[model samples]
Target chain A: MRWDFASVFDNTDALLVGAAGTLRIFAICLVLGLSLGLLVGLGRYSRNRWLHIPATIFVEFFRNTPVLVQILWFYFALPILLPFQISPLAAASLGISLNSAAFSAEIYRGGIQSIETGQWDGARALGMRWGQAMRRIILPQALKRMLPALTNRAIEIFKMSTLASAVAYVELLQQGKLIASLNYNPIEAYTAVAVIFFVFLWPLVQFSYFLERRLRRDE
Target chain B: MAYQWDFSPVLANAPLLVEGLVNTLRITGTALVFGVALGLGLALLRLSPRRYLSWPAGFVIEVFRTTPPLVQLFWFFFAMPILVGIEMTPFMAGAVTFSIQSASFFAEVFRAGIQSIERGQWDGARALGMRHDQAMRRIILPQAVKRMIPAFMERAIELMKTTTLIATISYADLLFAANEVSQKTFRPLETYTVVALIYFVVIFLASQVARLVELRLARSGESTVH
Candidate 1:
């Protein structure tokens, strides 16, 4: 019943590397997912069915399925389908971003919808092109409303980066699992990782709350 | 560039996949019932006036909610027996962790739903000389329950997807069975594609149902809810 963190401390370098791997994937997915999501979000708002239907399907397929399953599918199926090999790290990143892109698209769509139709029409009335209107008027307003939700989603994908461990990407949880099994002390290892994650993520969670309150006050 | 795209290997192993799917539902359903009840209790504790009662519950709920459920799954599956001196089967560990994780989320949903009720309703109940418990039970909950339905179902869909994490610990879940079959048959593409399709269909249907419920509630003028 005695807890020993000595074994965990001994492996701090490995865990740090693992945490670095997680952050790397998190950073990659955050950029790719949100960018792709923005495109898809625009597609969702487009008048053309060509854009709308496909965007909706993409969002629905990724959002409905579990990210773990999606990761496995990417790790296994994509290489075969492409007739080329994908490194596991790339596969995991692709999977996570695609999954996150689905949610991001919806979040973006919601933000856009939250804007009044009158503001949209007013932009047109002001002799602005669609792109100019969006960039100048609609976006400035929607981004403020959407910042908190988007940050929350970003934090979510950051936590989800741990699932890369399932694909053998050697992220934080995998590092901890290996160490725990090696040292015959699963409790200590998991406890260490839990504390690490809490310390790392608690700030983001706090910031998300602050954003939520600030947004509420603005309303 | 010619891939055969054979699916016979996966089709031959349909029974195992079905069993795994059923197991997935079982885990999610069991977790949902207990999680929601425990969540309601946690919400009550959090709403209690006494800090001694609410603070600990609030802290636990926040920690669980913020942390990844996958890590929690690992801790419960690997660390719990060592810490508590109680041996838990893989399924039991999965169920317990998911229950706790889902409870944390549901607590927030319930709290939000309760808080979304207008203050005038509380004032009206007070003016009528109704006790707090009576007002909550008789006046507030009926309305809140209706609002909670769409959100609860959405969480249920999310919870169903999350149950797949149990496969990592070698539980015989749909994804696990698919993995086993693919490994044996050397048809990873076929087996995994089918598994993905199954998940897509199930969750897609659930989301559609949730959307219909939300639309109906909105049509009926119950849209001013959390």
Candidate 2:
């Protein structure tokens, strides 16, 4: 029950492996999630039901469900339902990426919607096509506007990577749990993991604030 | 191992799930009330002219706001007990963590709401011979609280969703109940689907209530100023 910082760090390489796994999953999910989010966001605003309804349902289903459940479903239920087998890491990444997409889609939609109607009119007045206006004029500004929300979501996605540990994905928390089980020192093991997370998370938090202030000043 | 989708086991265990749901609501409700109170105090402290008080208050808000709630919950449930030599039951630990986590966000909401009120309003209150505390109590807080309703409602919805994290610390909340059923029947899909549906109903209802409140507030012509 005593604090044992040295014990936790004795196998530092093992912990670093867990950290590397955490970073890998986070990076993969961020890229995939952001891409999917843009598609879903555009789909939500589309006039056709072909695009909008499915995107709407996807957003609602993922957004409404507990993320832990979503992780469990992908990691457990999907294999039985799917034709081929997937690795645990793949399942966890897919689950996190898809859920993050649902949220990011909403963020992008909000950012895009916040752009003024006059700006759209102004673009039209300049004889730009819809796609041209969106790509060249609207999206840049919208993306800039969404940087705060996007950074917050990225941090959230990074934190949620820990949930992958629940399904035995051997992320930082799972590694901590393994050490705790072995050593019967949950306090030290988990606290060390928490400190690791805090170290990773603190910079992102500061960066987001700095970016927000800079953006405000720019405006 | 093939997992089948089955609801019969979960349905038979309805009482357990219902009990968990009740506990979930209890934790969320209690946490929301206490969090709001703490948030208001913290918000006021942050706005205070006293540098020592406001600086620490600001730091606490920043720390809590940035860290994941799961990490905070784990630290409180595990670390605090060892450090303080006081063991908290899982329910108590979850409640305390949720309250502290919710307070940080609510404090930010409150601070924004308070700061949005024009300086002219404060000057006007001062000219009427009202002291600072009296002006805040009678004029500023009421207006700030009104302007804050929409944001506060959104935060409440978020807090409700976050209550599921209590399952991590052995609190028998809705998510925990679902996990129990899933383990018993190995029907992760069905058990979680039902759990998600329950959450959707609660949150959707809350969203409706928020809209109604927003409508009522707008009708009263207070929302126009913001």
Candidate 3:
């Protein structure tokens, strides 16, 4: 029933490093997942069968399975499929990016689809090439619309990054487990971890809300 | 060089995987029922006019939703015994934690459903001289529940997938069974692939059902509106 803050305070540096590691995992996943997802997303909307089919399979396959299973698969099995071994961080990031890419692709597709048909027509009416229109006309507006969803996915990625610990990645949750088991103070250790998550995530949630409000106002 | 993909290890351990799948479903089903019940209660509390009732409820809901479920799971399984002076089995701890955390998310969905009912619905209820509780139960809820069906189904799908977290606590759930089979057979690749496929099939089917329900809800909502 009693919580000892002293044990938690004593391991502050370790927890902070764990948190930084977590942030790094999240950052890499967000950047790579979205970049790859952008391509896959455009492929999702593509008319060609070759591009569209693979993209659909990729999205559905990743979306349907648990990210945890994927992480385990990457950690335990992926190296067997490849020539070389990967570090835990590398394996974890690979698995998470694949999962994130699926959801991110959907978010991108949603953003692109939301733009009015007339916007495309308007671009053509101005005699702009398709590439010119996509880059300068459609993309700018689509990026604005996608920000809130991307913000949401960022939060999702943050939460999912906690799974890295299960794969021996030495992330925040794993570190908390170590410190707690060592200190025999689960309450204090877990409370610190929970507080850290809340502090980091609350702002992203607020930002998503604010963006939603602003976007709704724009309409 | 060619790599061999063996299915014999997974096939040999089929019974355990099947048992694990069933356990996973059982856990998810229990959590869904408890989560919805708790969520509805919390939603009503947050919607209450009394500051004393609503304020604390909102705070609890906010904190639950903001934190990762894994942390909560660990806290409940590991810390609960020390704090509460009663030991719980892994299943019991998981059920309680997932229910509460799922309730937090479901509470928000319920709030949105209730709020989305047009203000005119309330006015109409009042014009008919219905009391607040009566109006909510008899009129507002029936429609709101219909609108909420799609969201609830989607969350159900998500919750089902989250059942895998129980494996972390050494629960002999599907993923844990997969791990054991892999270690036993020394075919980690084959075993995890099978587990992933099982998840893919189950979730894919659930999502399709959700889509169908969504379409039906959309049609009914349109008619109900007019």
RMSD for all candidates, in order, please: 1.4, 2.8, 1.9
TM-score of 1: 0.97
> Candidate 2: where are CA atoms >4 Å away?
A1-3, A84-87, A117-128, B1-6, B215-226
Q: Model 3 segments beyond 4 Å from truth?
A: B221-226
| Docking category of candidate 1 | high
lDDT of 1 at B11: 97
C-alpha TM-scores of all predictions: 0.97, 0.91, 0.97
lDDT of 1 at B4: 86
* Tens-digit lDDT string for candidate 3 (B1-226): 8679999878989999999999899889999999999999999999999999999999989888888888889989988888889988889988998899889888988888888799999999999999999999998888788777888888888898888999999888899999999999999999999999999999999999988877786776532210
1 or 2, greater by DockQ: 1
Taken over the whole model, the C-alpha lDDT of each candidate is 0.89, 0.84, 0.89
Q: How would you encode candidate 2's per-residue C-alpha lDDT over B1-226 as one tens digit per residue?
A: 5555668987988888898899989999999999999999899999999999999999888777766677778778876787788988988888888898899989989898888888998999999999999999988988889989988998888888788878877899988898898888877667777887888778777877987998898898875222
Any idea what lDDT model 1 has? 0.89
Superposed by TM-score, candidate 1 places the C-alpha of residue A58 at a distance from the truth, in angstroms, of 0.5
Looking at model 1 chain B, which ten-residue stretch has the lowest summed lDDT? B217-226
Residue B70 CA displacement from its true place in model 1, Å: 0.8
**Cα shift from native, residue B110, model 3 (Å):** 1.0
- Please report how far candidate 1 places residue B26 from its true position, in Å: 0.4
Shift of residue A84 alpha carbon in model 1, Å: 2.5
Q: What is the DockQ of each candidate?
A: 0.83, 0.46, 0.82
